[model samples]
Target: MRGVTRSAQGRGELTPMESRILRAAVRLFAEKGFDATTVQEIVDAAEVTKGALYHYFDAKDDLLFEIYHSLISSQMADLDRIIALRLSAADTVRAILVNLVETTASRVDEAAVFTREMHKLNADRMAAFRADRRRYHETFREVIDRAQTAGELGTVVPADTAVLIALGVVNQLPTWYRPDGPKSPQQLGTEIADFVLAALSA
Candidate 1:
């Protein structure tokens, strides 16, 4: 995911109108299923003309794809940055998990909406989505694999299985996590990192 090109809004900077429209779309899509969300409703909520929305996004599907794409793209960039630091395998993995948990928890609405409505993405967007996710998974797995090969991490579980186990918990965050919960994202992320590191070291 290092060299992957981003969407039209490269570098994740969204124009004011784009941001407004996306926020409205995410809220509407979360409240009403994607199938039930209307372009008019989105425009109304965004307080923008239909033409303004069209200028930024080609269709409603684009909005849905962008919702998740922005999140994953930022995560990928963070992963790349973490890898570049060349930290010890334990520290690297901890940083990755902490960033992932914090980002996903911060945007629980985007994650939840995308999880439910991603099937509606067009074929091309769907393929891109899968590719992005695969790249993320493979990159994380490679980190674990390298650590295990160098005896930096215990091989209690295979690298692939370890990646799955680690991400499985993060992926379920949108289901039950609340921003107003007792634990802050940093606290939760640190706890998760500790748990994974303890298991790998054991």
Candidate 2:
């Protein structure tokens, strides 16, 4: 809280100013470290005033937490929706993986920001966020676990191993993904999912 201050129980969700500030935070935090970024720098890049920035976020740490929470929370909803569809385990897993790829492609900057700047969070918030992250990973783990029990997939793979492999494939896409490249985002997602499904088959 070395910067400005505001209330957490503001009116609605993120306002335009808050959105701008969050976007700027994502960029700056990814480019410059957390400690290196200043409120002035964020406001300057966001084209907003100090008052505007603080009106939505209390401090830089608050802004970072807000961004992180927003990203994870929304993705959880999306993943849950996809998982609720009653497809075969393999098909469901593929759909989830494809969804992940598209999501990463859509928000590579946020992904990078979240992954890189996570350590900058305060201890209390970090512990909470880590718990949330573990729950998120459990969604993937549960899917693989069910598949294993049903004998639909190879037992050679462990549940957590499936989660890691799935994440590793989807997370790496942002590093080299191009929207207008050879594959469409959906196509790339399907391809990656297919590879994972194939590997798990035997």
Best by lDDT: 1
lDDT of 2 by residue, 1-202 (tens): 3221122221124556677788998888888878899999999999998998877777787877776566556667777887888788888888888777887788777776777777888886677567656767998798889888999887777989878977886767657777778988799888888888888898
RMSD of 2: 4.0
16-67: candidate 1 lDDT, tens digit per residue: 7877899999999989899999999999999999999887777888888888
Task: Write down the lDDT of every candidate, Cα atoms only.
Answer: 0.88, 0.76
Measured by TM-score, the strongest candidate is: 1
Once model 2 is optimally superposed onto the true structure by TM-score, how far is the C-alpha of residue 138 displaced, in angstroms? Answer: 0.4
| TM-scores, each model vs. reference | 0.93, 0.84
The candidate 2 region of ten consecutive residues with least summed lDDT is 2-11
Candidate 2: list runs displaced more than 4 Å.
1-15
| Steric collisions counted per model | 0, 0
**Model 1 alpha-carbon drift over 4 Å, by segment:** 1-10
